[model samples]
Target chain A: MTQEAYRNRVKAAAPKSPLGKNIVMAFLFGGGICTVGQAFLNWYLSMGLPQKSASSYTSMTMVFLGALLTALHVYDRLAKHGGAGTLVPITGFANAVASPAMEFRAEGVVLGMSAKMFIIAGPVIVCGTLASIFCGLCYFVVR
Target chain B: MQTLFIKTPVTVEAHAAVVGKKEGEGPLRDCFDLVAEDIFFGENTFEKAESKFVSQAINLTLKKAGLKPDAIDLLFGGDLLNQCIGTSYGIRSFEIPFLGLYGACSTMAESLALASVTLSCGQISRAIAVTSSHYYSAERQYRFPIEYGGQRPPTAQWTVSGSGAVLLKNGGRGVRVTSVTIGKMLDFGITDANNMGPAMAPAFVDTLKTHLKDTHRKVSDYDLILSGDLGSFGMEMARELAKDEGIFLGENYADCGCLMFDLKRQDVHAGGSGCGCSATVFCGAILPELESGKYRRVLLISTGALMSPTAIQQGESICGIAHAVCFEGE
Candidate 1:
């Protein structure tokens, strides 16, 4: 078959997703995850932590919860339903690191899991650190 | 089109199926030879566990056929692993002349076709065709880890964590391997790794058309026209494509993947897939039906998507292939 004809056929036969429905799902599920984080932050504040510390502790809790859910095989279900909502959070980072580590764990702890654990998240971490350093340098120069 | 039929018939003397605990709980639970309580089968990793399935399947089939390792002239098998290491590592200790094959999920059909051809030539008296696939092992190799908690789309198929083997001889009293139609690779330019059913449907229909044309057979000729592991969506697409070619598959068509698991209860969205998808089903469900004279003549077409993580990463389209083997019994 000709490439052009084949491409046209595939386009016709392939199923299309509803963008409107997907956006609504993303908003609901994404908002749901953030609401849980907010509740955690409130709980930490009520337990005597300062506002800033409570916010930091909430992030930590969310990351821990993400990794735990990933380990329990629950987060994939959330991400599947919520799409980018689950992906655009600290929890996504936790899943990113935990996923590869668990996969490579069969290879061993030191070389397999430990070395390849940061494969997906390493770039984000490196870039985030470098961007913060650049911001700090800009502040110093302005001062 | 050239005839893909064998001149002399090959015989499937015996067969064996070894599945995981999850498969044991499925609809065909009682059909398998042994269902390992542990998915690992006493292996350290899921990879090794998969290898163990291949070895045990071969051993069990050989035993059922009442033959020793030396009685078999050749061992042809493969798996969904890189380099087909699962097949190699499993059959290594047996000292059999091994031909490691890779047709992805279509490997079992590929092996059977080659084995039958070799036997019909009168050179090899006996050959063993086997293939295996493991869920966790394939996931880690092709996708992310099971721990990733990634939600599977409805089109995604659950890879069967099992192994199946058939001992084929020159002539026997069991199911007769009448002929095999080798498949051609067809690329539809589909790039999505998750949706393989649509990508493979065209190739499957192409093979079915050619097989019918070459053999002068119709959809009604066989008791069943079985596709390997096209799952639910792919099977539907194949039927639609076949209908377009003026070949109505109708009630005679079924997919091993679709029949292997209960879609609703088992949580297998698109149905069971993988090399074991067809292999275990053939040895477990189909072969038994043939033996009981339920399906006198059946055409088994195993379909495969020939794409790797590297190829998909390089933005290459997935190509699909389907190999057909005719099994007849009195």
Candidate 2:
């Protein structure tokens, strides 16, 4: 068969990811993570912290939890079932950075762990920074 | 011209299979010679662990055959690691003449075919063919880090962490290598690295058809026709492709990948893959069945996708090749 024909055949035969199930799981898990962050914020607020300080502390707490779960090898299991739910949050970013670091740790500290720590998260940081700069320039000009 | 009929007997004297924890929990658990609970196999790194598996399999095979490493005329081996380090490092202590192979997942059959041909040519009296693959090693090299929380598609296959070895001699009371058909590299423009079944099915079909045509035998002539590491989807594709070419692969046809694990309980998605998938299944299950006179004739076609990470990144379609070996029982 022609390559085009074969490609079509393969496309037809390949099994697709369960979109509905994934969406539901993502919603539940993502919402659950957000709920936890809100709870942390509330607890910190009730402890007499300001709103801005409370939010920053909550973000830091979530990142620490993400990194800890990844180290314990639980985050990947959660992500397997949670899909985008675990991936769209700050915790997910922590996992994205920490997983590669743990994986390449056997190669050593500097070249292995630290260098590869940002392999997955590097692109995100670069694009996010660039986009923010662009938006900042636009805001400055309009203001 | 692709198929060669062995005039001199090339018999399988002994064989061994070593698998990791997950595969030990599989349906063929009882068939493996050694099922290591630790995937590390007592090594520091996964790569070293894979090498340990290869060596263990060879040692076990040698012990079973009651032959010293020096008695073996040649050793043919390979693995999925870069530069075939798994085979080289694993077999280094044996001090035997070695020729390494790199047929991707098809290394088992490629080595077997080459060993058989070399033995049949009367150049070697005793030879061993072995191949292995490790799940973690393969994953880190091919896909992502083990701890990476990325969801794999349903079409993805679990690489089998295992090794299989077989000893072949000029004459013996064991399974005989009757014929071999080397396949041509064929690309169907498949680009999805996750869906390897379809990427390799065409090559399996081509090699199977060529072997059948060359031997002038029908598919039913053999007691079993097994494809190496095609998994579920690829096996189905092979059946469909073979049907299109007027060849009906009946109930006797199966895939090593599908047989290597429990599809429902194992969560292996499509099924087990890698060089070890077919290698372990063939050594652990099929060889014993053939030895016990349960099967008279069997055909093994190990298919491989020959795309590297660089090639895939460059938007090059994956090309596949398969090697077919025919084994018969006395």
Candidate 3:
């Protein structure tokens, strides 16, 4: 009858163990995710990048660079794996910005296309913008 | 045919909760002004668990709406069931001309929009859009039972174990369905239905933008832009995200999902989900606020994810869709 009804029946018949499988699949993807994260660690090891410099570099570049790849629609493939894999920080923020930019494209320019696109990403940019400014002041003070 | 200069008049009436065959009705009973014995099981039908609760709720709502069998133009509803069997049974019992709608939490908004347009077009006169939910029965049947001790993430919300029904009329100077902002189910290709805030945010942004465009009203115009079930974390995320667009929904943008249970007492770290979340809030919270002149115009945005575990297993991305209904109180 209704799609909901059909889904309910299918869900009722769904194997319970599948949740166990999902749990395992979720973790397996996470493990793969960690190995990639380690590669960033390895970048420092291989390049002789400094400790504090490498850590900041890795995290910042990871988020900012991931934002770049995400806009190009490259990292979306890995996100399909679900959970911790997609949620591991850097890529998540990238997703935050790229999604709205893509959506607002259809509304043309006035408000929908220009203004609405930043709803989610807007906060990130605001915080990020302010944070950088604050950090600049601190850097000047310390220097 | 009746013509009003405002938004649609949709009232959630006749709310009743089953107190677990327990000692008392708890805060919910007091809030809805429902009597205890009003709950009764439908005989020879689906077991007394899910089916009975829904039927009892429907009858209560019907009574509150002052509706008789022949009076209800069309019965539009669905629940967590196969073929919306619970809704089917409710429809069968009342025998009102029926149309089943499934938008998960957004079902109430979806049905109201349809019912309102029908009334506005003279396709139907008096109509009812109803949705019922039961946490205990639904958890047992679909997801894990609470007793199962499943480790829920911060993203998850408690499914509201309640029922909500609204009666819409041809003439209510209070409100009319003026303009609707339709939303697309943005998956962002996410599959984790358990943590739905992010999945739902895209749809929320889309719908809110569309509503402003169609109605030509700024966010500040409406007193509230309430969502169905985005929990505490979801609310924060929505708030933080909305600010990025130079839009701030403010505290006026609360969600029904976050208010279903006393999360602290129930160990509901987040809030609630299901159709009942939005339904009860409309009847209990928003309606009262409106009636008291506390808020003039309100927008209820109910969001739902259009995905199943099977779809997830089949590697389908979880998509979220939201529909908005604007209601103004007299």
Candidate 4:
């Protein structure tokens, strides 16, 4: 059979991911994570911290929780069920940075763990930086 | 003819399978010779643990055959690791003449076929074929880190963390290697690395068709037709493709991936995969069934995807190959 014919067959035969269920789970879980962050921010603000400092502390706390869950190997399990829920949160970024560090730790400290620490998050950082610089240039030219 | 009919009787003397904690909880849990509670198998790293799994399987097979490692004239093995390091390190302490293979998931069938051919040539007296794959090692190499909170699609298959070893002798009273049909690489334009079932189904169908044609045998000639690691989706594709060619794959047809786990209970999305999937399933389950006269004649076609992470990223379609080995009961 031609490759095109086979591709069509594969498209038909392949089982699709449950988009409806996944969206529901992602919304609920993602919202729940954000709610927790908001709760942390509220707690900090109640302690007389400024709004910006409260927000920064909340993000740090969420990242710390993400890294902790990843170390405990609970984040991956949650991500499996949560889909984008665990990933869109700061916890997901923490997992993206921490997982490879733990996985490649056996290779050595420098080349293995340290080097591979950003294997996944590296692309995000690079792209984000480049985009930010481009936006900054656009803003300066517009002004 | 692509198929080689072995004139000299080459029989499977002994075989053993060792699986990890997750696989031990599978449906075929009791079939395995050893189910390690520790995923590391007492090793420091997952890679080393995979090598240890291969070693344990070889040791168990040797003990079952009541022969020392020196008695084996040649050893054929491989795995999914880079440079086939899993086999190299796993079998290093044996001090046996080794031939490392890299047929991807089809390494078991490739090694077995080569070992059978060598033994049938009357030069080698005894040979062993072994292969292994670890979930963590394969994941880190092919997909992502273990703790990465990324969701896998439904088509994704769980790599079996296990190893299987089989001892073959020149002539013995057991299941004998009857013939083999080596396959050609076929690419069907499948680029999704996560969906290996369809990517490899064409190769399985091609090899099965070639084997049947060259051997002048019909599908009904064999009691069972088994494909390695095609999972449910790939098996359906194979059956459909075979039907298009006017070949019927009936109730006797099964895939090692589908049989490796309980699909509903096990949470293995598509099923079990990797080199160890077919190897462990054959050694732990099918061989025993064959020995007990449950199956008179069986055909095993192990299919493999030949695409690397680099090739996939470069927008190349996955190429698949399969090797068919026919075994008959005495």
Candidate 5:
């Protein structure tokens, strides 16, 4: 079958997911994640930590939570129901790394788990670092 | 030339199936030989767990027939994983002469066809055909990370975590493998990996058409006609295609993937799709019904989408194949 014909038939036959429902669920779930981070930030502030330190601690805690959830296989369920909500946070990065490591663990330590850990998140890290470097250079030139 | 049916008949002496927790809770719970809640199955990794499933299935199947691994002349098996490692690693401990096959989700039928043909030709006294699929392992290899919180489209199917093995003897009181129709590669140029049912439906129709022609049989000749892993969407599409060919597949037609799980409750959008989908259903559910003489003649057509991550990445369209195995019960 030609690509056009297949695509037409597939589009007609594919199941239709409710976009409005998914959007609402995503909003609620994403907001819930952000609210949890806010709570962590507030808790750290109440303990007299500096704002900078508190923010960093909040991110660290969320990342840890993400990794833990992935290990326990709970994040997958959340992702299924929550959709982009689970992915639009620092937790998603942790999951992206941890999931590959867990999957490739069978291939042995060096080549499997360790090497492929960055398969998903490697591009994010490289681009993030590069953009930051470019901004830093711009700041120096302006100064 | 690619589509043909078996001539001489072979016998299925014994068969066994092992499934994961989720599958065990489904409608066909009693059909499975072993159902464990844990995906690990007392192993460290999901890969190991899958391998154990295959190994245990083979052993139990042999034991059910009162035969040892040494009694089997050859073992034919495969899995959804790359390199067909789930099958290779699983059967390695038994030290049986192995020939690994890869037909993605259609592996069960592929292996069964080969084993039946080999036995029918009198080349082997006994042969074992086995295949397995694990949800976790298949997910990581085919899609995103297990924890990636992306919403799957309704077309996507749940990969079943299960294994099935069948022991075929030269002759037995069990179901007789009457014929097999081997499929040719048919590419519908489907690119979406998530919707495999639509991609594979054409292949199923193609093989079914050829099988009917070669065997000089009509759809009504068989008591039941089954398809592997077409799920709900593909199953419907196949019927539509068959109707266009002036052959209507009525209620007797069922897709194993659609029957493997409860779609609404299981959250499997289209249905179940994996190597184990048809494998488990055939060994666990279908074979027993045949033994009970509830059905005299049955046709099993297993469909598979042949695509790799590399192939998809290279922008290649997904191709499909289906193998049809006909069985007659005494």
Candidate 6:
């Protein structure tokens, strides 16, 4: 049942639905999310950012924004609908990181969520950033 | 189809693996290659466990059955994917003609039934029916992992990811698939992928009734009857549903799901749900007993809940598939 897994559930809950509205709410929330992403992308572009820079800015803005919302449990509330919509984008990763942290939120910032929250995502970020940087450096060296 | 008797099953093999933090509990699952430490060590373990399982199963089954490489005519098998990449991909390494098949958990039985009929019809002298699955592959592709600890409702039946093979050939002093009863999976519009037991129960009942009717055998005719991975809940539901159909599968009836996990220990909540779940038990435990002539007759009902995440999200009822293979000793 980890946030990382989107499907197979071994210790799954008793079969039942959370009901009608939860599904519809997914679309409503998903549209709002994309609209926010668009707004951020526009704002970054308006500030005279280059295309790649604006893209990175938008991606980061959405991820961070998703992280904040996920921390607040708002994205989880919206996950029932967008199917993978809300969860597939950067927000899903944030939710993956934040939900676990939020669960241990009461345990405090250091030992609880902050430590274990990024257990799944922390290395992903580190390795990804490091890999990208490494590739860039390799290109410069070859050039 | 007419009857063609085969002695020993040509092949039998099994493997299981656990990824991330989940404990590998089942007797067979416990023996799997643990990916937790490897993933921890930055190993692209990926299908290592599953691939190992396929190789081990083929090797074991071939060894136990005393079959040479060239003896196997055609291999029939499949998995959870629409294209059945799992079985086909792993089987690519083995140089054998294969016809991929899928009936979900019932795949083993379906393949067996087809092979039985094929032998009966004298199309080929021998054939191997292999089916497999893995928790990690299934989880990565199908549902959430334990790391996320996502909340799942009861309706979902865990997708079983294990493989099992049954070899059928000419005469021997072993158990032969005497007859087969095939059931069409029916979806009653229940869309909850989590609680697949209930969605699949009706299919079990319908097929059981069909088998008994076709064979003209009573419930007591067979010494033992095992359903593929219907799990504990489906076992209960099948019993109840059978009562309505004037059949009672009580004393000797068992399920792969119930046997796969100690619900109390892992709090598995349900029972084991995977292709290998039922296939392993059928080939490993049940087939051995059948070979020993412990029972003059046995009925193996492999069950399957054919539901995917897309189906559930689309709000579609689940379909259940079951294939009954009658094992009779000479």
RMSD of each: 2.9, 1.1, 19.1, 0.9, 2.4, 13.6
Question: Per-residue lDDT of A72-125 in model 5, one digit per residue for the tens?
Answer: 989878888788888888888888899888878788999999999999999999
The regions of model 3 sitting more than 4 angstroms off are: A1-143, B1-29, B33-48, B145-147
Q: Which 10 successive residues of model 6 chain B have the least lDDT summed?
A: B11-20
Kindly indicate the candidate among 1 and 4 with the higher DockQ: 4
Please write out the lDDT profile of model 4 over residues B1-330, one tens digit for every residue: 778888899999999999999999988999999998787889899999999999999999999999999999999999999999888999999999999999999988999999999999998899999999999899999999999998888889999999999999998789999999999999999999999989999999999999999998999999999999998888888999999988999998999999989988989899999999899999999999999999999998988999899999899999999999999997
Error of 6 at B33 (Å): 13
What tens digits encode model 3's per-residue C-alpha lDDT throughout B152-232? Answer: 565666666555666677765554455555567765655666666656766776788777766767898998888888777
Q: What CAPRI class is candidate 5?
A: medium
TM-score preference between candidates 4 and 5, better one: 4
Chain B TM-score of all predictions, in order? 0.98, 0.99, 0.86, 0.99, 0.98, 0.86
Q: What C-alpha lDDT do the candidate models reach, one value each?
A: 0.88, 0.93, 0.63, 0.93, 0.89, 0.66
- Model 2 RMSD in Å is 1.1
Task: Report the number of the highest-DockQ candidate.
Answer: 4
TM-score of 5: 0.93
lDDT of 1 by residue, B109-155 (tens): 89999999888899889999999999989988888767664556677
CA shift of B213, model 2, Å: 0.5
- The total number of steric clashes, by the backbone 3 Å criterion, in model 2 comes to 0
| Superposed model 6: Cα runs more than 4 Å off | A1-143, B1-24, B27-45, B154-161
Best by TM-score: 4
Once superposed on the true structure, which residue ranges of model 1 sit more than 4 Å away at CA? A1-29, A46-50, A77-85, A123-143
Which model is ahead, 3 or 4, in terms of TM-score? 4
Residue A9 of model 2, lDDT score: 85
- Give model 2's docking category: high
Question: What are the candidates' individual DockQ scores?
Answer: 0.49, 0.82, 0.01, 0.93, 0.60, 0.08
CA error at residue B152 for candidate 4, angstroms: 1.2
Ordering by TM-score:
4, 2, 5, 1, 6, 3
Interface quality of candidate 4 as DockQ: 0.93
DockQ of structure 3: 0.01
Each model's total of backbone clashes: 3, 0, 14, 0, 0, 48
